[model samples]
Target: MKVVFFGRTSNGKSSVINAMLCDKVLPSGIGHTTNCFLRVEGTDGNESFLLTEGSEERKSIKTVNQLAHALHQDELLDAGSLVCVMWPKAKCALLRDDLVLVDSPGIDVTTELDSWIDKFCLDADVFVLVANSESTLMQTEKFFFHKVNERLSSPNIFILNNRWDASASEPEYMEEVRRQHMDRCSSFLVDELGVVDRAQASDRIFFVSAKEVLQARIQKAQGMPEAGGALAEGFQARMFEFQNFERRFEECISQSAVKTKFEQHTVRAKQISEALRLIMDSVHVATQEQRIHCMETREDRQDRMEFIDKQLDLLSMDCKAKIKKITEEVERQVSNAMAEEIRRLYVLVYKNELHRHIEEGLGRNMSERCSAGITNALQNTQTEMNEGLKPLLPAPVREQVDKLVPRQCFSLSYDLACDKLCSDFQEDIGFHFSMGWTMLVNRFLGPKNTRRALMGYNDQVPRPLALTPVSTSMPPFPQGSMTQEELMVSMVTGLASLTSRTSMGIIVVGGVIWKAVGWRLIALSVGMYGLMYVYERLTWTTKAKERAFKRQFVEYASEKLQLIVSYTGSNCSHQVQQELAGSFAGLCQQVDVTRQNLEEEISDMNNKIELLDTLQSKAKLLRNKAGWLDSELNMFTQQYLHQGR
Candidate 1:
């Protein structure tokens, strides 16, 4: 695995490489500069070469003037391919692993006629394109994106905002510059994706003054060589600043994912809990005999109805309260945690630092172009609704609203927005609770065993009643077949038809009791009152039958109600799970895609940077040679003129 950078000419690729290496190997400059591919191989001891024509050649130091023609022709590269060369100083660094660094001639310098930057980019696992902060996301950069993207899927791309400090006064101030650059960088990303919000062409992007890191690294190395006092503190500060940026970014992403998952789970758990509670409340009031056993007249029935109604009201209220509590708990636990994390990140991580990270890590040309194009396209999308309408009725006579803005109202007003928002929330908040509460009501409301307690089912057997089971030979009810109503009716009928022999004994007793007139009169009065009491009790008994019938109807209705609520809630849960899954999956995919894009942007930026370095190195060598030649020419001309005189 290695990092290769490529981009438009003079995008500070040289400065990026030099900074990365903590050395001044490549001079950052403009124009036809790079002479050959300078391969920075990490250990692994893999031997390869840039053979002259066909034979193996030895690596040697050559002046820029000597390599000028091949640099222009790009001939040093054997048919323009990758050639590995080990970095002598970092030999120890390479022996452990393989992370080769390959630098190509600047895009502008690589054979003016034979262009193949896409090939270089395609070969790299991670392409890092470096662009200057001053002229980033230029038109030329856009072309580079088109070329490289044409070859392969850019999975791991990075963008390094090289020479980032050029835009600001101090290293501190560069953060703002990074933000501005990233905003433009984001545009390019939109362009590439062809979307308003999508992961651009890169995996990651970052804005760092590679120059600063390089300078800091160099200074630290110098400090190591020579004992320093204040330099140590400065070194510590730089390292801290760098690490802080990385930490904050990682923390933000981690916390965001946790918060999202937490909320999702909380909502689902509360729904299940509510369903269980609903089932419990409906079973508490029924008695062992499934009877109310009320010993009262018609007046009692009305009083009982009133009490039962209040009980229903209380149950309903309790269900509502329970739902509210669950919602509050979810909000308190999950939302609060998210808020606290956000606050912590804000205080510890600088906003500017985040922007810089984005710029450097995701500032690749392909990423920028993709993001920008997409954003522009979305923003440009415009169409008016085709439906035509006219008012149908006169406006309501208002006391206040009409005076403030008469004839300037629409249905989708601010008030409607508020209402709409509230309506949308009700579907979410009241969702499972409403179903569970209904199930509870259904389970209890009907005249089942529980309902008898409310409506008053009397378990009374009249004093004179005698049950006679006349089992017909043809057919007889099974043991538990007779309902309480059936048995009570049979007993009352038997008492009414009691034989004359049973009456003869009562008559004899009546005659004897009558002879003692005074005492008999007292007994007769008691008997007369008891007869009236029977009459009253019989009427109450008739009322109880009616109450029992009503309870039967209520029970049947409750059973149906129970079925409906249970079915509805169960169905709702299944559907909700499916919908939630779809929604969550889509969101997760979006996040992953966007993050990948940012990372790719970072890689591209890094690649482009290395290309710049190679160019600058070749150009600097030529520049020095030119100065030497010019000095020698001046000396020769002066001597010749003096001797002729």
Candidate 2:
């Protein structure tokens, strides 16, 4: 509890506090000795110290003189600055009970009354206005309390008319003067400020000589009579009034301090405890709801994951079957296509004028066609497979699988040259007397019948006929004795031989026959047989060679395309399956991670709920305790008011 002294300068404001302390701990003089605000409070032990404003250094005050000197040194130029004087609680009864006395610089000295009040008087439990008893309350002193009344709610004020002992010089007017001061001070407090009623205001005002009280108290403490020399006539009565004022001041300050300071704090603590309890309860509920939500979400994810696993198994099986079927279909289609292309190879060779270098030009042409055909087939297959797999996958996985489709399943180092299909064809277009009879016979009979007979001869001539070897073993026969059949056999066998020496011998024999037969017979026979032999050989050889090439190329090309179909189809199928599987696997991993996170969140929420539960209980207990204390404080305030009345 703090009691602040406020009045005009030289009105003994510091002397009032010193008189209460019963020591000259504060610097008090006729001038404005209290330059700054000084707050005197009690310390725990005998250790008395002076704490200047904005300085931590403690100046020891072992005696009253030392304390006075310390206070004098701390006389700050600014009236708002404060110096705290700590005296031993054992020495002063008021200090021992937590009573702090603040002595301000004269109110009339500074125009900054608001700064002075805010700095020293706002929290003061009791304001003691030290008015000079020799004079009426000054406007500055009255105006100061008016401001205090505005800020504080019904502040407890005591008007101590100090230097009242001076009234003894005019003893005849003392009673009238006392009556005038009492009426005016009481009217100011009751009518003007309206802080209290006339009765309470009467009790608040006092006529006291602070100097006489201090002097008397000091002399008494030193084992001297309380009355000193040159005393006023009513000095004893004045001392009694001063003690009466101290008694009322103590009661008012203690009660006012409780109501003003502790009551507000008690109310605030009650509100805080209740607010904390409500907040803890709200947090606990929120955490429980969040934990439940996480659990439900985790359960839903688990169910989704199970469904995905089943779907993946089914998709895997279905994919394998589809791939197998597609591979077979590709092989069949590609093989048939290639076979048809090879069958038409002769058209490419013949129509494109590639007969001269048919092997190179036909190989290059077929290679380009094969590459384009196979590429188209594989690309189409890949597209179809991707489309088929897309519908089977989940939405998230499908998009990834679509993007992951292999661009090209088959990459070849070189084009399909169809090497075996472009083999060298033996072109034989030579004349023979063996075909001379067949030509003459074909002219009379139909061409089909002639072709049948020639085919029979063609088949036998290349075989090792026993009769042709017998000719070489037989005795030398004259050309004149030989029959036409025997001669024909000899000539045909000799012509069929590939050796140059045999062909040269056959040519010499034909020349000899020409010479014997004469020019007319040889020339007419040669002209007829030569034209027929040449025409028959050309047609037969060309047709036969074309048929043989087409047959061989078809077989070779079909085999090559079949191999390509198998490899490319299988590879594409595998890629599609891998893409699907990989996408599904990635999605599964994400789901698992989400589940893990949800589990952790649920666990965390559980812990938070538990913690909030504990805090809620503690806050509830604190709220109950504060409520009890607040009720008791209100009860005590009511009792005090009744007693004062």
Candidate 3:
């Protein structure tokens, strides 16, 4: 058993310990007396002291006074070190019971002394807080002991109200004062420090005059005033019977510290148990995380593939619907674009003023002009339509392909598919535009010299008509009509010769007719107005026919283009579905492989956790057994204390 004496400077902490040993083995004085921890234990008929420093050999000392001198002199020792005394004191009751007494330096003297107590003195089985009983527990006394209370268990601590001899002025008054001090200190422990039992509180508080105990022991050793003789008046009357306090202290020490060895054993075992618990908690958390990851991986492998497959089919249908709607929109855009271009051309032709020659020239080349204008207007519109259809293309196939294959391989597949779709769209547009244009000319222009403008055609005169495979193609044109180039040339010649022809014909016809009319000016003017009106009617008729032709072309082209675009869209949608399925399936297989690897790792961690659980169970059983042994030790010590009493 180990016992530590704790208190303020000059509080008689060393005096109490000296009295317990019945030997003045430690120094005590007014100012900063003992500054180092001194451990005093029993030895076999030999007295010695040793000073220990940091990692240096313990130096043996010849006398007890050397221990105090070395501390005061700061020689033969380092700061934060202590001395141990193995004295051959066979008469000491504590040494007989295997108890070692520790005299700590007065607390709160310096941070160094406090550090020494906190670091080295915490493991004592019993702590005796020795305060001078001249006054009740002071604020400093309560504070110092409160700190000690924090480090040690409450059951292992006791309060010693030392130097009770002063209150002997009136014995009855002194007794009442001692009771009040005991009660006040007991309440401080219960109310301030949460000590549970008041009875135990009162039992642990001892009021003893440590000064008187020291004096009595010294005088006895010197054999002054023979054994069993009455004492002389002054100093001898001051000898309070401190032996009762000593016996009570021995009793408390026996029951509280000596018998509770198993408690110390249990404390160590609990520390090890707590360390294992923390490690186990970490392992368990790790295992739980891995298990959750493994479960999610398995779920992804089983459920995600089926869900993606279903979504792919739904996506295909949605894309097909989107493609149909987009193509219809493209048809409308193309028709609107063609109409706008025709309106612009009409403005350009009419803005210069219409004439018979210019009207005829425009009519002759109207088919070629309409074809070129429509193609240019529709070029940008067609490109916009192609881009709009891109989102309708399925993403999963391209996305999976990119992930699983090299970039070059994915690029090859993507580019080839796009090129094929574009080529088909261009071919269909050309076929339909050519067929629509051919039908329009043969029906409205009386295509006597008509030929396909967009497709390759026989450019020679009197060429035979060629058959076309398109269902919308019209019958062959009649022969013997002016070609578009010939008509344009003839119309230009008519315009250039118009001024000379009009002057000559008017003179010849007007002279003969006016002679018949007796040279009447009014009659000749009326006939000229009539000829001019007929020429104006013919010019208006030509414009109406050109307007009719443009309307017919627009309607025909819009219908035929829609059919061709729809066919191209269906083929592209089917191809996209096939590519998507193969690539998506390959990706699912790779994910499954990763999940299997995780499952293997999770299994290994579970096995290790199982082994740790077994060890934890064994540790708990050993701790319980230690607690039971401690209970038996308490019972035995209590019976022995009662027998001694």
Candidate with maximal lDDT: 2
Candidate 1 Cα outliers beyond 4 Å, as residue runs? 23-32, 43-55, 61-83, 89-96, 109-118, 170-176, 193-203, 224-645
lDDT digits (tens) for residues 1-645 of candidate 2: 888888888889988888988877777765337778888999897898888888899988787667666656653537788888888888787788888888888887788888877777778888888998888977888898999999888898899999999999999999999999999999899998998898788789999898999999889888888997667889989999999998998778767866677566656765675565566556656655665675566566556556546654675566556555554554454345445554564555443333334445434543464546545645664565456545444566567764544353453222334444334533333443445555565564444445544443344434343464456667965435656654454454454443444577778878999789987888898887788767766766656666655554444444454455444444434544454454445444544454465457556656665675566566556556655655675676567534555
* Weakest ten-residue segment in model 2 by summed lDDT: 412-421
CA deviation > 4 Å runs, candidate 3? 29-32, 55-64, 75-80, 89-93, 112-117, 170-172, 222-241, 258-260, 267-645
State which candidate has the highest TM-score.
Answer: 2
Question: Per-residue CA lDDT of candidate 1, range 530-565, in tens?
Answer: 776566555655455545444443333333333333
TM-score of 2: 0.60
What TM-scores do the predictions have? 0.31, 0.60, 0.40
State the lDDT of candidate 3 residue by residue for 1-645, as single tens digits: 788887877888888888888777777655437766777888766545554545345455555576666567766544355677666666565686678888876665655545664776576677778877777677766776667667666636678887666665567687688789888878987887775468768666777766666666777788864223433333333343455556666776766653456446555555565555556555556555665665556565445445545654565455445444444444344344334433443443332223332234333333243334433433433333323322322355334433453211111010112222223222112212223435554454344433332222335466655565634566645667877766644544344356445688667777888777766575677777667656655555546656654444434433333344334334333333333334334444444444454455455545554554555455455555555544554565456533544
Error of 1 at 231 (Å): 12
Candidate 3's TM-score reads 0.40
Query: Once superposed on the true structure, which residue ranges of model 2 sit more than 4 Å away at CA?
Result: 29-32, 44-49, 57-76, 166-176, 223-237, 270-318, 331-406, 409-645
Q: How are the candidates ranked when ordered by TM-score, highest leading?
A: 2, 3, 1
